[model samples]
Target chain A: MKTILSVENLIKKYKNFKAVDDLSFDVKKGEILGLLGPNGSGKSTTINCILSLLKFESGKITIFGCEMRPDAYDIKKDIGVVFQEVAVFEELNVIDNIDYFCGLYIKDKEYRKKCIDDAIKLVGLEDFKKFYPKQLSGGLLRRLNIACGIAHKPKLVFLDEPTVAVDPQSRNNILDGIKKLRDNGATIIYTTHYMEEVEILCDRVIIIDKGKIIASGTGDELKELSKIEEKVTVEIDSLDEKILEEIKQFKNVDEATYNNGILFITYKKGKNNLSSLIDYLKKVDVHYDKIYSERPTLNDVFLYLTGKELRD
Target chain B: MFLHNLKYSLKTLFKNKMLIFWTYAFPLILGTFFYLAFSNIENSEKLDIIDIAIVDNEEFNNSIALKESFRNLSGENEQEQLFNIKYVDLAEAKTLLENDEIAGYLLVEDSPKVIVKTSGINETILKYVTEEIIQNEDVLTNIIEEKLNSTVIDGSIEEFIQNVREDAISMLDTSSLQIRDITSKKLSYTMIEFYTLIAMTALYGGIIGMTAINQNLANMSNNGKRIAVSPTNRIKIIFSSLLSSFIVQIIGLFILFMYTVFALKVDYGNNFPMIILLSLTGSLAGLSLGLAVGTIFKINENLKTGIIIAFTMLGSFLSGMMGITMKYIIDTNAPIVNKLNPVNMITDGFYSLYYYTTYNRFYFNIISLLIFSLIMIILSVLALRRQKYDSI
Candidate 1:
């Protein structure tokens, strides 16, 4: 796949604080790349730099092999951006807003109508074509914002928390629309704090902290890089110190903590470790209530790498 | 793209109906009020007759001689009832004079004297009446000279003759006539001035408080940013805005002009087309002024309104809309500012229609408005060139 967008050593500073520092990434064509970071982690700065909305002190950004400048009109025409904050003309209705943004590129009225109709249908805002931004619900407004940005059928699109502060139904619709965009031969750069969204939508993910990319791989590959191997949870009516000691002696066990009648254990990397632990528990004559083990999730991988909770 | 921008501008304007009402409708209503007040003053002044009271205290059995003398003395034609003249007793006259029921009272005595409670006596009536009495004195003098020649032992009438001559001479000069006429004629632009003033008030009122539209433009996908990024020349956008402003100004000017012509019945002179042309040109100045102001001040609606008012009042004052020759010093030295003032150009344009039978000054005024408009448009475009959406 061809590289749709490439940024090298992007740096943005305000007075003394560096908003984006030494950030480099490449988004290939026809792939969904998730940009995952915590609050104040330079996510917005990086997106702004890519859009040429903010100036960078040191960086090389090439969109479709053209240098980005104030007059890079052609490049801008091919690129679509949905900001984290919902930005649409409040004066215009959903249909007109979509048409306006689409008309920026496709000037032909006939073609613009087709594109607008498609965009409206894609975002499930067909019922709200005549509604102004003020008249629409929050979730519906979010859908209108996404429809405006992607209406031009851009080769590469940037969705910056497009589903942020939306209801579950609207979030689901936006996720579905984003997946359809990727499937229709368009590359997408998605950013969000929702780990589940990234796991469900992104083909690959890049986790950044303190203005540097700490990890970059597919979801499963990044999960493998996490220090956690497996999570084992044992539910019991009550737990004695002797049973805790026996569970601690199991091989491949990393750490164990008991709280509120549930024993949580983290094990080292090993296959059949859960079966071995269960067999050992049976041989030790400990009455087991229930046992369960599962692989680390993307949330676990995020917490392990960023050392911070996802929702914080 | 032009349509789209205008559509959104109008939409935002509509969505905020209260804003549009204040910007467009409110000024129109206020303008109409001012128009009525000023037109009423003009109409009333023309139809009003000055009330005069004559307190006849002299018990003259030979009043015919006095009346006949007045007819032949003054050569200037006199209307029989120039002053709404009424004869009354001294007490009644004094009471009416004090109460302002009568304009003034003339007490005829050995020496005729007048008493006025107010200083603002009508000059035209005063001149006509004084001339009539002077003629009466001339006839009285001729009769006295005849009587003296025919009779004997009439002691020197020198003191009486001297007083009579002095009174006649005093009444002939009537110096106040020139000053009073000039003031009244100069004030003739009341209706025209009011119309232009309201047009300007409406324009500035709208332009100044148009915060809602400005804010919407600022928040949008950056019409400024997009123009900057696009291959489409930035000059086109500026031109488009100027063109749109020109359109709006024309509509405002039309409303004001129509109101003056049809509703107020103001005489715009034989060169009616020229007056419209001048008004249109002046509106360009208004538009440019609005653009320059909008560009310089980047904030919310309240600040925009305040700045608009400041500029409007400054322009109106310097244009001499508030008073005549108050800005004469500025008008002479800084002709550009005065000429560029939309209020001044509009008022002066109408004045040219009234005073000049030839189109010489009218042409000059039109050219002045045009040049002023051109300069403002150029400066506005320059100011607009640097316009960008700054984050607030």
Candidate 2:
């Protein structure tokens, strides 16, 4: 696949603190690239550098085979950015706001009108064409913000935590609209802290922490990197600490814990770990209601790679 | 692209009711208050009549012409009267003068003289009256001698004397001597308050300029961040936004000007076109000042607004917006400050148009305003040239 965006050795500093430190990544054409990180992990700073909206101490960035600079209008014309903070004019109504932003790129009156209408429909803001920003609810306002950014139908789009404070329904609609944009041949760089969103939408995921990329791969590939092979959860009526300790001694069992009449077990490269646990439970005469085993998920991989430290 | 930006900018700025109130309504309201407070002062000055005393001795009784002239001067024609005369003995006249019951006392004889404790407007009038009486008596005596010597046989001496007395009374009529010189084109001192009000209105354009800068700079607002990332050139954005703000401010100024001129009857000179042009330039200066301050200061919006208000008010205060004497005080103490202050330049421009027959001062003020505006705009553009921000 052709590379749409490439960053090499990006370094952004604020006095004594480094916001984006030697970051390097690339996004291919016609694919959704997920940048997953906690707050202040430099996801926004890195995106800003790529768009040339921020100056870096030392770095190189290329978009569509051309060096990215502040005045690179040709490259910028095909790029769209939806900021984490909604940035629509409060004085303008929904339709006018979208049309004004769309006019920034598409100057043709008729064509710009069509693009604006399409964006409005895509964001499900058709009923709010004449509503000012202050008159709209938070969810509607978020949708309007997204429509304003993408109304020009640019070939490349950047969505920076677009669903940060949106309701579930609006979040779902925004995600679906983003997918439609991708399917319509627009390359997307999606940044978020939610792993589920990355799993659902991203083609490739890059997990970052402390201004550095900790891991980058497909979902299954990232899961494979984790030491946990499976997680077995068993619900029981009663369990003893001695049996839990014995379960921990199993050859494939990595860790076991019992709480509130439920037994949780993690395995390391084990086959049929659930059956083995059930046999042990029967032998121990521990009555259980139910048991299930699941493969290691992307969340586990993210935790394993970035650690379980609390981040703000 | 410029037209598009301009169109949207106009729409956005007009919708801000608070901006509209400050730029247009506040000035009109304040102007009305100034009108109410000052309209009566000029009228009161016009109606005042000076009081004087005359000694009623044998000489005063002998001068029937002076007594008749005094009666005619103190007639029922209120607009014609220059003095209210009181007849008394020499001792009583001196007592009245000493007690401040009258401005001065007249000692009547062949040559009348005025005696007063102090000199003032009333005392000056008394002196002028006394001199005029003496001069008229000399002229009448000369005319009588010339008629008797020439043997002009038209009428009797009594009839001739009566004709001369009537002519002398008509010539000495104090009614024609205007107390306040209303015919001269000196502007009312109260008009200074109105001029300063207009100056303040023009400077309110700064708020709109500040808003434009806030909407364009990346660190100022979320809207600024979005626009900063767009493909549009930053200069285009700044130019279009500033132009739109100027247009809005000019419209507000025109409304205030019309209200003051027609509704409140405030004189802003007869050169309508030049007045409008000066207002436009003044608005430009105010707007540029705001843009420069907004770009240079990395503070919050409310704090920036406060700074703009404080700065504009200081300029107005120095220019004598609060009182007419303040401008005179500043001009006497520190004339250079008036030349440097933008608000003073604006008010002075209007003042020159009204009071001066030549455009020298007016053009000087306009040029100073233009130069100040250009410097501010250049500084703002330089400050806003950075496309990338250290933080947003």
Predictions' DockQ, in order: 0.15, 0.46
Q: Where does model 1 exceed 4 Å of error?
A: A230-302, A310-312, B1-19, B35-193, B196-198, B205-234, B264-270, B293-298, B313-392
Candidate 1 lDDT, B20-42, residue by residue in tens = 55445655675567666665765
- List pairs with backbone clashes in candidate 2: none
Candidate 1: give its CA RMSD in angstroms: 12.7
| Each prediction's TM-score versus the true structure | 0.69, 0.80
DockQ of 1: 0.15
Tell how far residue A38 is off in model 1, in angstroms: 3.0
Distance from true location, Cα of B194 in model 1, Å: 2.8
On TM-score, the candidate that comes out on top is 2
Compute the DockQ of candidate 2: 0.46
